[model samples]
Target chain A: MAMAAFRREGRRLLLSPVSYNSSFAARSAILSYSELGPMGARSISTQAVRNRMKSVKNIQKITKAMKMVAASKLRSVQVRTENSRGFWQPFTALLGDNPSVDVKKNVIVTITSDKGLCGGINSTSVRVSKALYKLTSGPEKETKYVVLGEKGKVQLARDSKNSIEMNITELQKNPLNYTQVSVLADDILKNVEYDALRIIYNKYQSVVSFLPTVSTILSPETVEKESEAGGKLGILDSYEIEGGDTKAEVLQNLAEFQFSCVLFNASLENACSEMGARMSAMDSSSRNAGEMLDRLTLTYNRTRQASITTELIEIISGASALTGFSQSARATDNIQYRRYACMIKLQS
Target chain B: MASTAAAVPFWRAAGMTYISYSNICASLVRGCLKEPHRSEAVAREKVHFTVSKWADGKPEKPSVRSDSPEE
Candidate 1:
């Protein structure tokens, strides 16, 4: 939790939490790297800095790769959603126009993703569901939830287990198509009952912004009531049914179609938003890794130069006592070995 | 308002092709009645049939896993 908190605050903190852990690890590494005392151990600080730099560079590479993948995915999902707009909009006709929602007996469908690290997209929906439940569920009012995505299910299950009508973990596993959602609609229609079905999902407003949005599917009776409530003619009344099947069967199928369409749109929008969040998060992490690398390289060079200058001063002055200079010369040779070792570490 | 929705059974909506459905799953509610009286009659009918549908038991949630995702 602390690590997550640090990551969330990392943008303004302007550093990854790893920087703290890396520096601490490097301190311990310096103690181990310096087998000789400070005077003989010429590469302690430099070796530690080198290790830090390598890890930072590696992180940057990973974040860069993730950012690229997320960018391409975001683009593809955007196209998919745009292309499917024709399919989703027609079904909006099934939305109940009735203002008198049985908020008491509403079936709320919360759409979240199975994955995490994409920001607060999943948590926001869960929070809203909880708030709505707390506010409305009472003696005459009970709101059942159809939770889509593991993240949202886990979040909601922490508090309101009984309120959850169903949880779907696999909807966001792939680029989900209609068939997967069709079965979910069938399940809900075959099982759950409500006067109003409310679908809650994330809406991708822009590259950096997504908001939780709601769409509702009303019962046919509620639709009729809503239409009657409105003094003007209702739009849904125009969708004429002609099949030889019974009126009840037609309405049931229509409800299934509307339910499927709404579910499909919610999942698509949530996925698109999730991809966007990941892209932005990875882009920032990559940039932070670059900055840490710059700092580590600078620290390594300064320490190396300082160590070299101090050694040269000791060697030059020792020339004054040339009688025993041979013994001191051996000490200088150790500096050469240390430099060679440092170079190898740097290469690694 | 769109051609993606098939208003008839077996998706026999005229002029709209199956290709569109496969491409985007865009068509919906094309089979519903436009006349208020037809829907009114259906609304009257759903109350009686709904109980039987519920008695049939809920379709279980499938254990479908997502494709391997990024860490």
Candidate 2:
């Protein structure tokens, strides 16, 4: 312990020209140690060093606790998001194959969580919707809006002078309905004002990533073309008729039902995509917070170690000067110079 | 050696009408089977399916033609 203090004092004295007196005193204490003078004073300084170390350990404990909490929340949110994926894959495939859906004067329905802290999940969607709106040419009358979540409604309402056609903030708690979805579809279908319909939402890409997507609900003519083309997929193969009026009625209903099926399928898929996106965004943010906490703990430990070394050198040098030192001042100065060079190299 | 070849009936191997009509029936069968329980009803012959044509300013007419002399 005395040698460690002597080495530390030699560095300090060489580095700071103003602290020469302190270094001279430390050398004197080392020389006096042989004479067995003032050993009791050195014991008090060692106890103070132990106390400093204990405080540093406490800080490390707090940072580790925060990392654990963030990780736990990430897990639950990821499960909620991933469970809804069963319905998304086939839906997206259907959408991709039928690409003729026009969207010149269509309505966009967006969903976002009401609560924040999922980190940028809500804001990124809002920004994407705003950019989509800006990309439109022609008058505002050409565009219609439907907002699915509270956050989306509030965000769109800020820029929109006209009221939204449908705002479904209550949907988070309740189960979705064909009635509500069909009613919305019927209302849009009634008005031939729009060339096509589109929905904007986030598509979950992974546990920690989501991409903004714009899905098209094709126009009536294009839907007919798709159904006709889909007939090539031979999905409609088992209808048998007894050669009567019952067959006629069934065919008429089948034609209408086919169109409605496509609309319902698209909407269901859009909803699943939104939930998945939310899960991924939250998971990534939780991971990032954990990494930040680790770096902070490391920095806190290093700064603490430096402060302890400084204090030890001060006490050792003060004690050495009080005793009658036999070591020459010239020899102490040479040792001090070499020590400062080593410390400077370590710091750099 | 080939004094005469056996004569086949018009609707038999000598003609193509049967094959073409059967292909249309096959297509119709394929088109209606995708619905849930509709496949069983289709197999039972309880439902009749037809395609109709509507010309300009005309009401409707059956798109298929029959070769029966009685019709």
Candidate 3:
């Protein structure tokens, strides 16, 4: 037991100064380790924040430019739509009063944009079509589709692939005009046959909203019936008939014009709606980017400050340790001189 | 086609195009067509009306004897 006690004392005697010195070294090592941790994190966060900010800024630039372009385009479309009302309004009144039918045969013309990122304009049309499908479609009824843009074509084809009769795309390559509508009308006339025609498009509400609207156009059968009645109670019968154009013939031309007119006006309205939707959508995305930028900047600043504070503490502690080492070395020399004095006394 | 061009206001197609001009003829045809209730619009091209005269103030009556403009 005594020998064991002696070994323990010997070990303590040999390690006492080193153990006392090691406490300071351990404290300095902890400070240095902590300093490196925040130092690395701050650098990585700084670079990441810079890259994220740059990309978001670029996206914001693109969306802002899109908003401006959409605004300008909306103005032009609005003008054309307003000016054409003279031809379309009265013509609509004459034909609008057609008798409703159980509608065994119906054709739906869905209008959307060739591009995306404009919000739910395209899906809204498709969803409206689904609602209308219950009214006009059944085992007894046949419904056909004419799609005006790629987005619509893709979405509708998912549900009604076989019903899509005409899929038109690449229209945004040029601004829409009356001739295209007319030609499009003529094409529908020659290729497809239908009893009733319905056009669904995004109706422009404002710079912030658009709603999908359904408008019914005069079909050949309805026009034939309306002309026979001659403006209900023969209001149009008073006009002196001077033309070689038969009543049916006049209506044939009018029907063609009417189709093109509705298509043209709807195209104008939809184009405006598309721009409005895009503008608003872009506006929000830019705002979101701005918010993200603000958050990242805050995180970056806090991390940098923490790293700086850690470094300052490290520098002060390291300077004090260097001074303590010098003082301790002088004290060790003083102790050794005292030991030598003790030996001289023993010899005496 | 040339005669139809002069009779309709083909010049209306030039100035106001941000998209395309191909549909100008369609617009002219739409414009010239008669509106049943108006006075000035009645003076313009009337698609569903009798051709009273051409834009040149010459006649295009299609009766048995008045087939030609000179008649």
Q: What's the best-to-worst order under lDDT? A: 1, 3, 2
Please state the error at residue A81 of candidate 2 in Å.
10
Q: How would you order the candidates by TM-score, starting with the best?
A: 1, 3, 2
Which 10 consecutive residues of model 3 chain B have the lowest summed lDDT? Answer: B62-71
Best by TM-score: 1
Each prediction's fraction of true contacts recovered: 0.00, 0.00, 0.02
Give the alpha-carbon lDDT of every model.
Answer: 0.62, 0.45, 0.60
Q: What's the candidate order when arranged by decreasing DockQ?
A: 1, 3, 2
User: Across residues A195-300, which tens digit of lDDT does each residue of candidate 2 receive?
Assistant: 4455666665554566776655544344444556664323432435554334323332332233234334443443444444444444454455556555554444
Candidate 2's displacement at residue A101, Å, is 6.0
- Model 2 CA lDDT for position A129: 64
For model 2, give the interface RMSD: 21.9
Model 2 bad stretches (over 4 Å):
A1-105, A117-141, A161-163, A174-195, A204-212, A218-283, A325-348, B1-71
Instruction: Extract clashing residue pairs from model 3.
Output: A179-B23, B32-B45, B33-B47, B34-B46
Docking class of 3: incorrect
**What are the C-alpha RMSDs, in order, of all predicted structures?**
15.6, 20.0, 18.7
Candidate number of the best lDDT = 1
